[model samples]
Target: MKDKFEFAHGEASVIQLKDISASGRARLLDMAFARLRFSLFVMPVVSVVFVWYYGKINEDYRVLIWSALYCCAALVTFLILRLYREDQKKQSSEWLLITWLPRIQLVAAFHGLGLMVLLPMVSHTATIEFKYLFTLTLAAIVAGNATHQAPMLSVFNCFLIFSWHCTVLLMPWSFSSHWQFIMPLSVLYGIGMFKHALTSHRFFVRMIWLEEEGSRLAENFKLAKNAAETALSDKNQFLTTASHDLRQPMQAMGFLIESIIRRNIDAGLKRSLDDLKQSVRLATQMFNSLLDLSRIEAGAVDIKLRPVNLNSLIDDIALIFREEAVNRNLDLRTWNRKEKVFVIADETLLRQSITNLMHNALRYTKKGKILIATRVRGSCWEVGVWDTGMGVAIDDKEHIYSPFFRNEHAWRIDSAGHGLGLAVVARSAKFMNATYGFTSSEGRGSHFWLRLPAANSIDFSPQGLAVNNLFEEIKDFSRLTGSCLIIDDDPHVCVAWESLLWSWGVRTKCAPSGALALAVIQAGFQPQVIFCDQRLRSGESGFDVLRSLLHLYPEAHGAMISGEFNSRELEHAESEGYLVLHKPLEPDQLYAILSRWLQLKQN
Candidate 1:
């Protein structure tokens, strides 16, 4: 057996594998195996039927011929099955194809030849029936097996020519003169079949190539997508880490400067200190703006939607810019309808977006009035800011909302602008599902607007009155007194908070970790306010520390402070009902919170 297999491999390599490449040989093998398997299964039953029918007409030698044909078919089936099994072992794909494909084709050729040989043996009395059966069987082979054998077109052509010649030879030429015409037509049909098989072979090869290419492209696309996602994740992490590390010293500097400004000094020296403070504030604002843009691009901004009073929201935004506009001697006017207008939106984001538009308006318009107004348009409300400044050119309008893209006109107007405000506005508006655009003509002015879906009217009068009276109930910070506890891993942050708190006439204690804060509380230092950093040096979160201390000191007003702004952390802190302060806390903001806590304690 081993010797026979070795001989077969040698013959296959010389005859077929030498003529065709490895892939072509493999494909031919696949096609041959499929056709052979189908023939092996169906041909025996067909042979039995043919024998029984012919035996009724010629019983003498019909059994002998059928037995011979059956035994030949059985041998071929056994040989083909064994080859197929050997192929399945995958010893060597190239060797298997070369060895087995010829065997499969040889078996198919014999099966066709055997059927052709049987046609002439049928009795002449049943010539019509014999003709019908022969033609039907030939047609079946041409239609079904021809296409599957296309990968080896030579085998298909050989089968077609053999079947056609056999049919022509068995024709009853003496009985009918027209039978002479059948030979020529049979030749034409065989030619057509061979042509079709060639076409099918080309098409099959093309399809295989296309399928392989598509699979390769899909795999490449998946790898590229994974790499891009990993890069984006790394960028977000770096920004988060950098923001936290950079803000610690900035926070300390802000508090120290505030303490100095509060002391008695000459007017000129006070002006110098105030100028230094303004510079610090400007730096902080630019840093925060860049951070905001990064967060928005990283998909870290969360939108919280509720029914918002558009009129009041606009009023609040206008108030924030009114002082800045006044300092520049520009009129900041807000015009809204007498009736309340409401829209469903994230109030904080909506406010920020509109504030960005107002800031741009105030920055560009040196002397012209800035008008912020609301108007109804169809089913939407348009909150627009119009500034009589140098309008945008035609080409600049398209790229105006891109990050860090400043127009020539804008550059001349304010070198301090980082060109991120409008980018943030565009991103935030999209997040809230609001549409924003502008109408401008150069040398006239630009009107930037945001359109929001209008909601059904409801009474916001009570809420408006409560908001109006919030600042009226302020407590003087000097009268407020409370001891505060600070938990932060950064020594600079701890020192900054403690100094700022003590300067406000409040007693303060500091701990570097949650365990140490617990120790301080155990030592009987009761704090009215507890401020914790969100991230610590010991790989523990400030939230965990706050939770632990709150359990021990439930009466303490707890707040989480950090330099970095993350949506997940913000949501977590809010859900836990803890006040969150961003890093580089302003002195007035700290005093306000402490005074509120102190007032609550007194009550």
Candidate 2:
């Protein structure tokens, strides 16, 4: 799965190969196998030589007995080696170490020096035959060291000492002269080999275990690293979605409170409420900026490019803040060269970018005027937002598009922003494949421009559907309203939305759960509009509820409200022609949606 091994469906199941362990046990076992193979090759040659030497000497029966014993030992050693080979084919390293190591060592030792003990007994018939026994003893010692590890070597040497003792005691007077010296040497060699074998066995066992542990640790660390990365990614995504969704309701609340305070007809109360509303709005904006950055980083924002009218868009911008501009005695004007500038772009995203620039300009500007203009320049039209505000220094220009970076002037003037507005604008420009730049003079003004390639021929033709302030239609929603079903698990959200809707003269039926909403529907409470939250307390989501309701009330307009901007939700809602309201809804935003819905219902 990780591009390590490309295994077929059944390959892994059938071929259960050993995984490499950090321990040297596997290597040690391989070395032991090699030694056995070499011993097997030498065994027959030595056996035949002993048989030939005995036959040529015309020795007594004793020599024949020694030769026969040597042959039998060699044959048994060879059989053991063959058995070991077969076992190696089936046994894993762990199995070999635990079950076969001790047995193999003892067998190898016995065969290695067993015949050498019978050598002195044949001296009466032929001393030459006794010389052959010594040669066989030396060979066994060497072969034992090579094939079987430590314990086997020790056994080999110990058996050689024991056999040599028996041979010396049985020796005839003619060969008894050197028996004492020969017996001691044999015992010393055997004891030394056994000691060394013991040491080797312990070392191999330790090394093997260490290898296994190292491999397991490596695997665990890899898994932990992947999990940490995944967690961080999810955290960033959650923060982004939460911020965006929270902004809508917060912005709506701010606007509504501001509007209510403005109509207070008392200057003191109006000022207080306005301040409160401004604080709320600023908080909402900061959260929205954070959300935007998160969404962009998560690769969740998708631009829906469509043919949009530049003039109409500019008009909408002007209308959104015309009152605020007028209130501050700042002139807001649009200079669109009397031709239609249509572009292939995401209308909402384009609006956001332009609005951010406008808002940023307005925030710093205490003065003369702000201008928005669009004109064809070569194959693209440059749409500009110019403001007489505290402009950027040349040094700070590049960094303005960096998130959380505020210029010295901006910090001195208004440091409230998350400093992500220009960054979002820049990312949007890149996403749309549009070019954007700014010309600014410190203490004088700044002009930000976006260049979008024209889509279709520029049509200056005007349409009557244009309204001066689309937001104005929202305030008049109370005049014509019907029963609205509110679905959300959060009681606070339900209460707030109901309060807002009641002012619009709408009768409300509320359900805290999707199942309850279904029960309400079954109880003959068919509302004209439905608002549902995306996540419910249980595993059920707003979509699940909407689907169920749609089956029963096909004509009922269902809208999903959430604190997340999921692509799946957007696409599904778009296909169904359902409105998606993100959280912290602004009155104007809510109004805009309601007005549109009301118009659709009328149609």
Candidate 3:
């Protein structure tokens, strides 16, 4: 066998040192082999054409021998190529280099000696026109070899040798004594073609290397995308667990504080209790804002749309912030037309958006009254919170809506502010299909507004507004008369629920698990309302516990209380027609549930 393709000269150092992979080498072989197979069939016709052209005029049978030898060479290359293809399927592509490289060199030999050298010796073309015509045919064949054989220089050089053979011997035989003058030009053209093939070979190898590099980069990008998604999922889970743990105690303390403030105590102590209550509410706002931003980033915020009464919503928000506004020596006021304005929006998201605006207004405004106003526009309602204090600078306006972004001026006033309040507002407005913007002058004040689409109350009753908004108002809890079933794993949380419900004249049967709650039912304690906490210590969610109890008491009202804002269980509870209340539990929300039960009982 002949030496390998690497024996060819005029290649770059990288390719000569085996830098071209086995697959790259195989691709080159595939292209060359395809051309060889096609040429084998065409060469027989070429031999026929050669014998037909010269044999009629010249009385030479030697031409037939040359044609026979050329056809034989084609036939031998065809048989070996077919055998190579059959075995190539079962073997690695590297076999093309180890086994087929030597065969390709032999294929070149057939074109050189078997066809080129024998052409001039046997076929005597007396006419100069036909002699040049034969030379043109050989030159065309030389050009075709450059296309297929350029991948391997060893094979390319072998095929290229024929052009020199024509220049040195065949052309001279055809031209007679006139050959010496034309010989130099033919040799120069032959040398140019040889150099061109070397460049083409380098280009082919460079393309193969790039293909391998691109494939590796694509795989790495895919792995990185998967890893980022997994890390985001893990972060969401950790936040959910930690939020629930911290909210359990916060919920219990809120209940205990509300229970204390309800009793007849000294005026001085009652004022102190009210102050502490305002402090808790402020802390709850900050915690909820941060958690909300995290949930939105994790793609866990699923906004639910519904009809919301702007009048009732504004009233509730005014009540929540009024206490803090008083402590800050600022007048907190709300104004709207006596008419009950309705809007199509997600009540939860709308409430948060407005609350963030209100909280932001309160944080910046140290003096002057804060006004929460609602206005009717064409096809929409605009609710705005106007405050008078240190207003935003012109440059800070653009980035104010971004999460955790605070300017130097505002940071000095409220060092504890996380800047998430306005960010939550922006996201909540987008999710609810509402729009919000602000107008502010530095050191004067800011007026932030949220606009929502006007919705007709014909689809839903106007009187049912209070029934829908669980956080509306803290009415006379003495009116709440119903038996409550509380399911929670934390002992402090259960006690807080019991004390708060008892104060509201709600008879309660508390249990730590679903099985124990069933035991209470077995003992003949029927409940009118069931309040279950999500993420129980028994590995059963509030939805799982309430599912069994709700089936047993179809007519009874049931609700889920949990601090997790983004959870499948929270979504599942709401889907099953149960009201899902997030912690720390609001006194007004529980009262809303109990009030509905009392109405049902009385009817």
Candidate 4:
């Protein structure tokens, strides 16, 4: 019983293997059929040529017999082409192996049989010619059919067996001394052709499979790319909206804090308020830095290049950091050749880059001094920040400029540092076409530097500064009085503007939209200065509002303010001759601009 069960199990395994092989061949038949069409077309032409040449040389009735056979073969080949074309339209693989492939094998068999029959008829007068013609015809058929037909090994083997038998039978066995050699060589050639056909078939199948897979992968990649782009666009839009909405409340808080600090309060209360102000300032700085990095990543930061005075720029940086350095008990200093050094660069970007470097230096250094200086290095000026701090290790140096990448020492020193300062500096420096690098020795110090092309001749006339001096030359807002209009969708921002401007002794009115601003102007309230938010409610923009208001009040000086850093809006505002400000606006900066506008109106 055990021996009988083993025999039954072996029979079942053989049957299963046969079924698997049949299914695999069925899957490949469609591709093989397509390749067979090329060989079919070539076979008819070769057949007709051989018949015509044989007929011309012999001038016998055998020409007509062979010509009829060739015609029959041509008709079958034409029918096969037609049938395959029709089958391809349906894309049905069901009947391909059983029906179409057999028909193709029948045509190949007919060609082989026709060649064998033609050989004996021409053997008498056309011995050498028959040998040459038969060999060439056999070679052409083998070469042409092998790649397409070899996928079905049984069909290929059938054709090869018939062709080799025909060639061996045609050899001059009775008289030729080399018949033995010739017969063996012909059999070997047939075996070699079979081997070559198997290789070509496998290569063809592999290449076709790869082509199909590659096409699928390409389609998937396209879909992924589109999805990623859409996500990025949505993220940028969210950032823009969030920045605007968040800054409105922050602007209000800043204005309220400044107004309270300016009041005559108790010394203790004033000190507490000062601390609160510092906290607010720090929050504002971090928020702005985050937004700046976002804008840089979103490709929204525009570079506006102009001649800048290195001395004046360095002086401003020192002034800004002077108090901070004092609080830290660190000396912040600048060094340069006594004369003014000039460079053509985007002043805002250059300043931001240098300032970020300065902030980074201050953040890292504990007790040692920080130096902001410039020196001529060949044809370029190297503006650098040298800090006596715990310098970065070699392992950490490469990643120090990457966003949110901090060394263990840095995290220990200040966990609050977002590690964005150097990243901003790197991006800004790149945007301005400047090369930035750093040299550091662990536990001693680090020197971060930016190399900018130096201007040969100085333009004595100073460039228009983004923000004018407020403390040294405090404008008398009390001496000047004018009506100012504030158009912003955010009520908190409008209230903040009103509170600050009213305290400066200027008459102020606020509107939420372009239509509302137009109504206010139509009511015969013409303001001397107009402050418009870049984005208003109800699908309105500051540009439209400004245009409508300006039509009524042409002499009013217009300024655009926004929390979002959109390069398009900035470019438009700049082109339209509007002063641009980002929020939460600095009290000194706002006062400086307002004082200047009010004084100009009075003048």
Q: Pick the candidate with the highest lDDT.
A: 3
lDDT of 2 at 251: 43
Alpha-carbon error at 526 in model 4, in Å? 8.8
Candidate 1 lands at a TM-score of: 0.56
Those runs of model 4 whose alpha carbons end farther than 4 Å from true positions after fitting are: 1-68, 78-102, 112-144, 151-158, 161-195, 238-243, 263-301, 306-344, 347-372, 376-381, 385-448, 453-485, 498-530, 538-558, 564-576, 599-603
Per-residue accuracy of model 3 over 156-201 as CA lDDT, tens digit each: 6877775455545566666776688766777776777777767677
TM-score of 2: 0.48
In angstroms, give how far residue 222 of model 3 lies from its true place: 3.5
- lDDT per residue for candidate 2 within 262-373, as digits (tens), equals 3468777866875676567445645555665566566776555556778777876776778889988899998986766687666556777898988888888988899999
Looking at model 3, residue 239 earns an lDDT score of 79
Off by over 4 Å in 1: 1-32, 36-75, 78-99, 112-144, 152-192, 229-243, 246-382, 385-485, 494-529, 538-558, 563-578, 584-588, 598-603
Measured by C-alpha RMSD in angstroms, how accurate is candidate 4? 9.8
Q: Is candidate 2 or candidate 4 better by TM-score?
A: 4
Candidate that beats the other on TM-score, 1 or 4, i.e. the better one: 4
**Order of the predicted models by lDDT, top scorer first:** 3, 4, 1, 2
Write one digit per residue (lDDT tens) for candidate 1, span 195-225. 6776676555545544555777898998998
lDDT of 3 at 119: 44
**Predictions: Cα RMSD each:** 10.7, 13.1, 8.5, 9.8
